[model samples]
Target: MEIGKLPNDMLQNIILNKIKHFRNDILVRPGIGEDCCAIDFGEYSCVMSSDPITGASNEIGRLAVHVSCNDVATCGVEPLGLLVTILAPVYASEKEFDEIMGQICDTAASIGVDILGGHTEVTDAVNRFVITTTSVGKVLKDKLVVSSGANPGDDIIITKSAGIEGTAIIAHDREDFLLERLDAHDIERAKGFTGSLSVVKEGVIAGKLGASAMHDVTEGGILGAVWEVATASGLGAEIYRESIPVEDITQKICNIFDIDPLKLISSGCMLIACKNGNEMLKALEASGIKASRIGKMTEDKETFIISRGKKELVSQPGTDELYKAT
Candidate 1:
């Protein structure tokens, strides 16, 4: 019913409820906040996740790859392959299609992943161009991490800044409009946020450091991601609003668009639940990744964001702020 991801309630009641996991090999099945599914294969587990690129038209191919791979990385596995499907409108040109494929290939190569076979077609499908990518990875059974593994007393860590993906998308897609209110340099810097869109490095680092749980900040921003992690783990969280990092350009863009930065899509940022916050932060810093301990998991089943001496309950994430701005 929404432009972005389905509401968690409807997703559970209408979709997830209908699907049953019949095999014992399914280490991880479909569930709220569980982006990647894992299947047991003897000593190792296969991890996979699929996502579509629908928000920005400029870097759809790059977005398609990173989004799905980022999901797989939440399991702390390096993606090795991708299955891509491309559907283009009737008016789409050959050059455009070639560019999209080139981007996909270049990005996959950069991540050291192979481009598995997939379908491509030009039809009257109601779209400019839609690309869906399914990233595949593998990890030892003992090393696998899931989103529901978080427990009470665990510290919540956020990598990078909030609204990283949204800022890049808005900066690139709405460049002309943003030029009216912002300088060219600012817009250029915001667009460059795309370079930081991968969470695989931090994901692996956190996983290796024995993080309790990991979730990539995607359709929902930092707040939404925290809510999902808490709900999935049957726990609660207390997030310090001021501790959540947000880039100045991202904040300005969100302000101009009258949207909440905390509720925007942020694929580059990773949400980690860990028992040793300082250790994880130090590990991330050593890897040249910026991270912050923003909160802690609680036994109480109510998620709250405290700001300026006021505590407010965080609601279920709906449409991403990126939709409104774009």
Candidate 2:
């Protein structure tokens, strides 16, 4: 019903209600916060995830690759290949099509992921180009991680600043509008947030070093992601608002649009659940990735945030704040 992700309750009732598990080898099935599905293959597992690029028109191709691959990374797997589907409007020009394809190719190459065969066609189904990608990756059977595995007392670690992807998308898509209201350097810095979208390195490091669970921050942002993790694990969380990192550029852009940076779509950031927060923090920092322990899981099944010496329950996420800004 909304522009972004479906509401969690309706999704559970309408979509997840009818789905049936038909296979026993399916290690990780569909669920809120479980973006990727993993199929057990004895000694190893294959992780697969599909996502479409619909939010940003400027970097559709790049976003498609990174977003799809990030799903696999959330499962703590190494993405090896991708299958892409392109739906173009009938009015799209040849140059535009080539540009999209070129961006996709360059992005996949940079990440060492091969673009397998896929279908592309121009039809009157929509007004603009829509790209979807199914990313495939592999992980050792013993090393697989899921969002539902978070245990009580585990530390919640967030990588990168909040609203990284949303900031980049807003800056790039609304460049003219932002330039009129903000410094050109700040806008440029926000635009460059796209370069830090991939979290494969940190995911691998955390997964291998004993992360209990991991969820890549996407449409719901950091707070939304934390809520999902707690829900999937049937636990609760106490998020410290002061500990959550927000870039100056992101804060400025979000303030301009009257949106909460914590509730904006964030693809570059990741939330990790681990027993030892200090160990994970050190590991991520050693790998040149900025991370912070912003919260902890609790046995109680209520999620809330602490700010200014006060605590407030976090409501279920609806449409991402990014949609309002756009």
Lowest-scoring 10 consecutive residues by lDDT in candidate 2?
A: 315-324
Model 2 accuracy (lDDT, Cα): 0.91
Instruction: Note the Cα lDDT for every prediction shown.
Output: 0.93, 0.91
Question: For model 1, what is the C-alpha lDDT against the true structure?
Answer: 0.93
Per-candidate clashes, comma-separated: 0, 0
* Each model's Cα RMSD: 0.8, 0.9
Question: Alpha-carbon error at 200 in model 2, in Å?
Answer: 0.7
TM-score of every model versus the real structure? 0.99, 0.98
Off by over 4 Å in 2: none
lDDT of 1 by residue, 6-78 (tens): 8999999999999977788899999998989999999999999999998889988888889999999999899
**TM-score (C-alpha, index-matched) for candidate 1:** 0.99
The alpha-carbon deviation from the true structure for residue 129 of candidate 1, after best TM-score superposition, in angstroms, is: 1.0
